[model samples]
Every structure is written in structure tokens, then in C-alpha cells.
Target: MKAFVIERYGKQEPLHLAEVPEPKLGEQDVLVRIHAASINPLDLKIRSGALKRILPLRLPLVLGNDLAGVVTQVGTKVQRFKPGDEVYARTDTRRIGTFAEFIAVAESNVALKPPSLSMAEAASIPLVGLTAWQALVEKGNLRKGQKVFIHAGSGGVGTLAIQLAKHLGASVATTTSSANVALVKSLGADIVIDYKKDDFAKTLRDYDLVLHSLGSEELEKSVGILKPGGQLITISGPADPEFAKNNGMPKLVQMIVGLLSRKIRKKAGKQGVGYSFLFMRGSGEQLSTLGELIHSGAIRPTVDRVFPFEETNEALAYVEGGRTRGKAVIQVVALANQA
Candidate 1:
């Protein structure tokens, strides 16, 4: 099986294409023949060693998170899906390797792909969609008539977050460049602040929740936009103590994470708002809900570009460039070319 793997962690290091043995299927796993995979900022951070302390991957790691494909076989204990089932997933954190010809995903982390979408389109949904679902539905508890600000509305997570927030009945405000204002609006953003021209914190006020995904400067500003008791959930983050504790990090690591977020938490406290970091987890149940939304026309994927499987490295680089409108996908198996 051909896969792209990172031999070491470095900012400019390139992924090498290698023929590796197929992943072993566990009792509760499903073996999938990957049709398409998506690139994410998390992939870049992992490759650059930015998340070493938190996620510590084994060397020569196959690099990808989101995948859409067909089930080639199911493990003995897997019953929800069988051979030939079309599925998509945000591979479990510990076994991520979707930039390959095949992967074995835990059945609990896999969901049937939305029937209305192509493999590439379904490939783009899982990670970002799960992030949005966890942030808005699970954590924020967004409600109708409430105002929510989602930063970076044109980015992968932002594009989906805006739609999910709106669908949940919250009035959505988001930040992006002037060129993408229309795009966010089309995705149901009620207010779009051109980050290049205007500051989001200054533009949005008294919001019920804030879904932040940017630098510390923007994160601090996000706290100020919310009303008292507002929830600020950040995906791109200085991980908070709660997150560290929830993930059961070592005591020293927990202390370090706490220190990293102390100032921001204090600032949010002073403003009478709550701040917490959200590192999204893979969930087949949540993906199923998102798939229904996609099938119902309530949410749509915004794919900025599609790269061939051979250009997986270039796809990762493009995502690192931070200029994409939505998600970027790698077509691993051209279904049209298949006999």
C-alpha cells in the first residue's frame, strides 16, 4: 500500500511516498480503501512538532486525519458496516493514517458517508464538521436568538462552524478577509468582519458565545466581545487546564498547560466570561448527525481545491500557506479511473 509518511518532525521536511504494509484490523475496526483525504492545519502542526508534547506521534507516521472511502472488510466485532459500504471518518487520534491507499479505523469513529456527496466532498467534512458540532452543540450550547462569533470564517473549521451555528439558531458573526465576506455570508454568517480591514473584537459585542481559532491576540479580543457568562471555546489554542485534565495529561504537563492559559483565563474571568480550549475528538455519532444535515441541504461542504494523491505534500504545504477558502482534499483513488 502506497502512503505518504513523515520520517521526522520539522517545518520544511517533506513527506516521502513509501510502500507500507496495510493496517491491521482490530476486533472493532473497519478496513477502508481510501478514496479521498483532506488536509488540515492540525496536520501541519503535527508535522512541525508544535504538538509533540500533547500528541507525540511515532516516527515515520502516515499523515492525514479526514478520509472518505469504501469499507473493504470489517473486523469480527464490527456490525454497523460491511464490505462495499461508503463511509467517512475523522480517524481516531491514536491511529491516524488516512493519506494512504487504505486504513483501518475503529468502527466507533466511522460513519456512513452522506449519500448526496461525492467521496472528495465527504472527505472534507469529518474533522471540521466534528469540530463545529463539539464546539457549538456540545460545549457552547448555542441557542436561538443568541449571538455567536466564530473567528476565521473562511478557514476549514470556520466555514463549517458558521453554518452549524446558524443552523442551531444562533446569529453568527465571523472574521475573514474582505474577499471572503460573501462566502461566509452564503454559509449563514449574519455578520462578517474583514480581519484585514477591521478588528473583530471591536466590531462584535455582547455575544452569547465565541468560537475562536487564531493567535493569542485574537483570542483575547474574543473574550471582550462576549456578554457576561458567555462561553468562549477555542480550537486553536493555548490548551487550558480543563482540557489537560480531561485528556489526563501528566501532572507536570497539566501544570504547564495551566500556566500557558492562566493569563487568558484570568482575563476572561475578569470579564465574567468562561474560557476553555476545545481539541475536538473523533465521534461517529456526531458525524452521522452532520451527514444528515448535509443530506438535508442545511449544511454544504466548501472545498477550495482538490490535489492528486501524488501531490499530498503540496496539499499540506498549501494548507500551511493559510490562504485556502475552505478545505483542501487529496484524491487518493480516482473513482472515475477505476475499472
Candidate 2:
């Protein structure tokens, strides 16, 4: 199968097209003929060796995470999906390599694609969609009539997060550059702060939740905006000790995490607020629910660009710039006159 792989993590020059052996499917996995794949910030971090200590990878690793495709074969133990079923997923990080003609993912990680969207659009939803869903619904416990703020409103996750918050009956506020203010507003953000010119911490107050995705400075400012007892769920740095415990790290690592987390936890305690880190996980059931939302016209996929399969390097370059309006997809298979 033809795929793009990275022999060493560094610049984009290491990315090259090659014919690699097809992956062997596990007993609980399904082989998918990939139609489209999307690039996420995680992909760029992996390509740059920024996550080397955390997510160790073998050399010549294939690069991609989100995929939308058709099932070609199903594992013996897989009952939810079958041959010819259209599916989409944020595949297991350990088995990631969606930059190929085919990939084998566990049945538990994939769900039926939304019927209302094309393969290209569906490819954009899995990773970011799941992140937004888990952050707002599962961890944050956002309730209707609440007020929530999402950072980077024009980015992949923020675009979806805004809509999800609105769908759940929350009044959403978000931060973006001036150019994207209208876009985020259209996506249902009731308030849009121009991050380049305004301070979000000063602009918003008494928020029930803050979905953070920025630097430490922004994270520090986020606390001031939340009302007492409100929550801040961050996806960037500031790893919580609970996250370290959940991942089963060594005691020393846990202690280090505790030390790192103590400052934020203490600060939150002083304000009667809560703080935690969120690293998204795959859940087919949640994805199926999200698919229903998409299928029902309650939510829509937002794509900023589509690159050909062979231009994976260029796509990576574009995302690294960190100014995309939404998701960026790679069209792996040529559609019949769809272009």
C-alpha cells in the first residue's frame, strides 16, 4: 500500500511517499479502505518529536489520526460494523497510521459516518468532535442555560465546541482573531473576543466553564473569568495529578505531577473554582451519538482546506502555522466528479 511515513522526527523533509506492507488486522479490528483523513495539532507535535518522551513511536511511523472510510473486512469478534459499512474514527493512538490506502482500527474506536456529510467532511469530525464532546459533556458537565467560554474559536475543536455548547442550550463565548469573529458567531458563539487586541480574562466574567486551548499565560488569565465554583478544563499544558494517576505512571512521576498540579489546584481552591487537564480518548458510542447529531443537521463539519494524499507534507506545514479556520483534510481517494 502507498503511504507517507516519517523516518525521523524533525522538519517536514523527513516525510516521504513509500509503498509499505499492509498492516495485519487484530482479531477485534476491522480493515478500512481509507477515503479521507484529516490533520490535527497532535499530528504536527508527533512529527516534530515534541511528544517523544510521552508517546514513544517506532521509526518509519505513518502519520495521521482522523479517518473516514469504508470497511473492507471485519474481525471475527467485531459485530457492530461489517463489510461495506461507512465509518469514521479517531483511531487508537498506538496504531495510528491513517496516511495510507488502508488502516486497521479496533471496532470499539469507530462509528458509522454521518449520512448527511461526504467522506471529506466526515474525516474532519472525529478527533476534534470527540474532544469537544468529552470536554463539554463528560468532564465539564455543561448544563443548559449555563455560560461557557471556548478558546481558539476558529480552530478545529473550538468550531465544534461552540456548536455543541449551543446545542446543549448554553450561551457560548469564544476567542479568535478579528477575521474569524463572524465565523465563530455563525457557529453560535454569542460573544467573540478578538484575542489579538482584547484580554479574554477581562472581557468575560462569571462563566460556568472555560474550555482552554492556549498557552500558560492565557490559562492563568482564564481563572479570573470563571465564577466561584466554575471549572476550567484545559487541553494544553498544566497536566493534572489525576491525569498522571489515570495513566498509571511511576510514583515518582505521580509526585512530580502532584507538585506541578499543586499550584493550580491551590489557586482554584482559593477562588472556589476547579481546574483539570483533558486529553481526549476514543469512544465509538459517543461518536455514534455525534454522528446522529451531524446526520440530523444539528451540527456541521467545518473544513478550511483539502489537500491531496501525496501532499501530506504540505498539509502538515499549513497546520503548523496555527491559523487555520477549521480542520484540514487529505483526500485519499478520488471521488467521481465530486471535485
lDDT of 2 at 175: 92
Q: lDDT for model 2, on a 0 to 1 scale?
A: 0.90
What's the true lDDT of residue 90 in model 1? 93
Please provide, for model 2 over 1-339, each residue's C-alpha lDDT reduced to its tens digit, 9 standing for 90 to 100.
Answer: 999988888855458899999989888999999999999998988888876655678988999998999999988898899999999988887788999999999999999998788999999999999999999999999999999999999999999999999999999999999999899999999999998898888889999999999888888888888999899999886788898888777888778778877877788888889999887887789999999888777789999999998888888889889989999999999786333
lDDT of 1 by residue, 1-339 (tens): 999998999998899999999999999999999999999999988889999898977998998998999999999999899999999999988788999999999999999999899999999999999999999999988998999988899999999999998888889888889889899999999888888888776777899999889888888888888899999899886999988898889999999999999999999999999998898999999999999999889999999999999999899889999999999999999868632
Candidate 2, poorest ten consecutive residues by summed lDDT: 330-339
Model 2, which residues run further than 4 Å from truth?
Answer: 11-13, 337-339
CA displacement after TM-score superposition, residue 199 of candidate 2 (Å): 0.9
Per-prediction TM-score: 0.98, 0.96
In model 2, what is the error at residue 257, expressed in angstroms? 3.2
Report how far off residue 116 is in candidate 1 (Å): 0.8
Local distance difference test values of all predictions, in order: 0.92, 0.90
